[model samples]
Target: MPKNSIKQDENINNISNKDLLIRLFSYLKPYKLRVFLILILLIYVMLCGLLNPYLMKIAIDKYISSKNLQGLILLAIAMFILNFLSMIASKTSIQMLSKVTNKILLKIRQQLYEHIQKLSFSFFDNRPVGKILARVIGDVNSLQELFSTSLTSFIPEILTLICVTFIMFYMNFVLALMAIIVIPFLSITLFSIETISRKRWQNYRRKRSNLNAYTHEDFSGIKIIQGFSEEEKTSRSFLVLTKDMMDSFVKAVRLNDSFWPIVTLSSGVGTILVFFYGISLLKSNRITIGTMVAFIAYISMFWRPIINISNFYNTLITNFAAGERIFEILDIKPDITTIKNDIMPKITGTVEFKDLTFSYNNDATILNKLNFKIYPGETVALVGPTGSGKTTIVNLISRFYDPTKGSVLIDNINIKYVNLESLRSQMGIMLQDTFLFSSTIMENIRYGKLDATDEEVIAASKSANAHAFIMNLENSYNTEVNERGSRLSVGQRQLISFARALLANPRILILDEATSNIDTHTEKLVQSGIQKLLTGRTSFVIAHRLSTIRNADRIMVIDKGNIAESGTHKELMKLKGLYYDLFMSQYKFLD
Candidate 1:
């Protein structure tokens, strides 16, 4: 049973006909000449198939029963020549078609990869990386069957059936008519089953996509699961999802399996009927034995094309689902895009948010109609309770997400009027959750400025107080951070992120809870380093530890998406407002 399931899974990965044809046509658009050549070879192969049975009938009628050795010799040589040519044609057709199909798959995967990179951030946020990868690689690869087999074979199969039928009718009208009676019945039944199967197949695809997403999320977060000792719980959860996936697959198979057997049985019954009726005609001398023999051969050859045509229905379903998934992604318009003819001007770090209002969804606002400005060379600290829009404000500043209303200006120009890359190039950000690539420490720091030299990387690391700890390591600047910086301590990761930001040399710097992870001593070290970096630059710092931002040129105390207080820390302290109350609350704990 386990072996059987493994085989079933292998078949399920194949693309259905709809997706296959759509993909093949699109990919083959560039290789139309090759595709046409493949089709021509297939037509030649099908013509050979049509001639084979006719050759047998001629030999049997003119030589075998006539006791003529010379005639038999010529017939045998003719048969051998036709067989040899058929073999060559078949081999050439298969090889050419297989190579073309594989090339199409390569093109499809490349296009999918390129298109996905251009998709907006919101699309990735809503979809899983594993599912996207599966669509690009797994789903696209599955379509090989349609191109290599179905597409190349389809025209030949139909042509062979037609040619064989016409020859059989010319020989004996009654026998040919009797044999073809099952065609319409088989076709109608296959069509109905295929329609139902396609819907089930689509559902199966969705479930599989969901399964991939869950498995990816689970494996990526394995460390967190182990840290919380939730392995058993996670396994149980995964088991439920796998079970549903299996059930969906089983249902699709059941529908697909039913059609194949019905087709096989229908062909068997038709052949039996043809044999009985043809023999009666032969015994009555209505048709010659040679004619009866040729008709039987045609009957046997006939059902293969029918079966192939029927099976293409299932293949079409798989392809349709795959095509829909691919098109769905390609159709999405990026939420943020650069405007036509917009050019960013040189900036001097001044920033202003005028009546900014935003909501992640349409429901409730996260940032209300509010206005604030930071002059050149000023440090503005944003302090707020959880869910008070501190990070949202910074996100808008970086153009990660745009405001639903109002304007954000940098150097007196609305951000929307500038080229996205140019506007963002003048700014640097370090989020609370730092992301490090699985590369060297030097590369991580150089990520901020792709052209930074080794010396510059070291300088940036020193400015962020990350150079000492990095140098203490065995590999120092060449140390691999591993995936998501898993090999580094939280404090070390934060330091590296700060170093990356420093390398950018931005006129506008954003520190979103940058010092939240370091120890008290390390925090003090980072604080001193930050003061040096922040000098002569406009900076926005979001700090949970209010003491870190006490010397800010201005402090904005935010509450529920509105700026409730704005002033120097000393002046805000005199008001004894929300900021004072929150700071004093934390101060008592410190005391």
Candidate 2:
């Protein structure tokens, strides 16, 4: 298995729910005033709710039993007014809290995205694109309901429970005592269920992330599956992944669903206890009939809030699990970080690798102790057998991955000591797999230098020999290249990439099999363009096409992470080393 795959199997640190909640709520600090207003509205609504039961008691005792029709009518009018006010307050609170929730979500998503961008390449190397997408989009969205309810339901329910308990005790202590007897039992049951449910919910989320990763991988590779006639096999694999996700979801839901029933059972027991005890008090004339009725209403109020609070706790646990996953990424310190006082200076393209050695995860080393230097304005060709560390060398030069030992230097300064943006800006790299965004051809070429004008983009395209085909398109340079440039041919995509690189006008250039996929005709066109582009830049070329490198100032044959041969092509051919053998293998027919 690949080193990255093994790294993915390692578990992330388990963060406590308390810590997760603290971090999650930190996003709400900026919207405190909106939250404060919502809190006031909720308290007002709770007050309105409390009034209805007390008013009912007054109407029953002073008006209904006494046949005071006028008093009863006035009380009914007051009740209606209170209900209307409550509705308005509730609606206003919802509107305000919704705005706060959306803003918090926006901030969280933005922070996650920006943090992901700052992370080093190794972070991405060990994780799938889809899994990262799941955390960014899916996991972050799971907190939306939690944020919305925190103010609307959670706060109001807690206040109602406290107010109801106090009012119950104020009316009659004995009945209040009886009503709450079942609460301790309910609390214990919920605590046990929550402990079990938390684990189940975490498993469900992991399964969900895995399924998303698998689905994305399949879609991205659907063409390969179809070409190989393995659609049924792929579908079977997808079904298995989805089934695992469903199983985990069902288990979590089952545990969560059990919670409501327990709450309901406890609610019923509390009401029964309060009813029987209140009847005894009424028989003794210690409490009036209206008071007895009010006690029952308060009991219902008390139990309903208990149920809401319980549900809120369950929601909190689930969202907390998601917050843990999100914070896991946020907690990762970027492997590559710029020095606090790093300098930003223009590079002259003199590149050096001093005793450089590298390995992925301390696994077998890809490059050994290697030392080499390339002068400014030199074009060097690196030829080797497969897995000879050709691409690794270029990656090191670009600082995509730092050397595990030793250093890479440019212009007599360590690349690590230089600001990454300044260092990378002066370097341009093109790979075999050309990636273009779903944008117009002009925008794609302009990506190399964001501020380049239209005329400059056109000049870059013409220099790359991409202008002719781009003009033939339906909208010329304005034509949209679909996702990953799928709308364009492989050769066309490579030429566009070349145009982008040329537009950057970097002091250093690295091309790793850039033209290996193009046909002879396209290669000829790109070859001329590349020659012009490499005129004054230090360039590294890795190619299987020997003809392209014959004119290079130096040709180095790398073998087992060491330079086996180095000299111009003519000098290496006369020496008949690895380079000569590779050249003969590809173009003996020319001789």
Candidate 3:
């Protein structure tokens, strides 16, 4: 099994039936009026059904037995009319219920999506995108059964069961006991099946999630897989996951399928007991032939609801795992509040790190108690070997992660005290790996400034040197780049991302190898526009190329979780320290 699957299984905390039922039922609170109407309709249908058997009893004893043909015909007509109305009410009620349940499903999915959005980066960091997607899309859909069955079937089944029980006992106590003789045993059997089946279904859901995670990761990295010729290896892994899910599904379904048979068998036995004893009652003249016949009808009614309730119970048990997974995500409190807080600071972009200390997963320290300051409008270039805290430095400035111990100040005000929106809104930080939504070029560019005009988008694109290429496309600005801008060239994607950040026009701009993908000609073309965009705004640029960082106001060489050296390019080259070593290394990579 995948390590993620193991972790997923470990994270499954047991949710009690009471808590699960209460939470699931709470979704119907907003649609209670509709539920009430459904109840009235179902109750009317039930009364019509109950009246059926009693009418037969009256027809046999009071009308047919007395040879009163007129009364019998009238009674037959009344029964037909009752059944017709019941049919109409039942159809209308089911239609109304279908609408109600679908709306409830939409409500639940919306809440899940909103909750997932609020969660901090740390939540995403630990989980796979496929796993998260499974919860949001697959797990949320699994709950449709719970919503549909609970409202349309479960409640009415219980009510019907109760009403049938009362009518049975009232007609004749002994015959009623005979009618329900097998119920206690039937209950025990179904309970046992449910107890065993619940765990199996839970296992199946986890396996399904595991399969989803693997499939997502596999497809997402398909380019790499094909590049490395690892298709067969991935296929074998997929087969294993499929077999695991298949085995679990079969086990759960087999147990659930057994439930109906046992209920049907029990119903058969109860009817046989009723008939055998009712014959003895008839012989003793303790019950009428009409009453005996009615008892048979009531016996079928009694078992009908039992069968319905058992089916609903099976559905509940199967989908209970899905419910738990959903609530588990909803119950999570975001590590950081995403909502706009009370403190909103006007930023001039002076960044300071005071005794900064950080670690990821409480493991190795990525940044040791480091301290530094960059003046407003200063262009600080961060250069370092891999894992030397280059990206971590900018991530801290953006307040993406709270420091393990220390404070980051924007304009001398602790950024932790400032509202997240207020802080991030004033800062534009673009990662080396650029991402674009499945949208048009214009829309993607407009994301940074929601109300940006078409001309402004073109201006920003021109500033990034992306205008030339975009104008050559089929739809120009309206052309959809598809997911993550997969259709665009690497440099084109980065350029559009650059345009987006540029459109934001932040007071502070952090470019993490922003021009890495652009060809030399494109980079040279945009350098002047880039400088203008950087002018009068505090900027942090993390790049490897000497040409990119040589022009920076101050170059900070980061290594071993701290600043190894800091100075202008020439001054650092004169120092003959870590900065000069880095510069010489890049300088040696000549054409």
Residue 334 local lDDT, model 2: 82
Q: Which 10-residue span in candidate 2 carries the lowest summed lDDT?
A: 1-10
Candidate 1 lDDT, 412-486, residue by residue in tens: 888876788887888889998899999999999999999999999999998888999999998999999899999
lDDT of each: 0.82, 0.87, 0.88
How close is every model to the real structure, measured as TM-score? Answer: 0.90, 0.97, 0.96
How do the residues 1-591 of candidate 3 rate in per-residue lDDT, one tens digit apiece?
112442254267779999999998898899899999998998899889888889999999999999999999999998999899999999999899889888988998999999988777777887777777888899888888777777667788788888888998999888788878888899899888888998998899888888888899899899999999999999999999899999999999999999988999999998988889889989999999999888899898899888888888998999999999899889988876634365656678788999999987687999999999999889999998989999999988887788899988887887776678777888776789899999999999999899999999999999988999999999999999998898999999999999999999999998999999989999999898889999999999999876887889999999999998998999988999888887777778763
Worst 10 residues of 1 by lDDT: 1-10
Candidate 3 has a TM-score of 0.96
The local lDDT score (0 to 100) that residue 525 gets in candidate 3 is 90
Q: Which ten residues in a row have the lowest lDDT in candidate 3?
A: 1-10
- Cα displacement (angstroms), candidate 1, residue 356, comes to 1.8
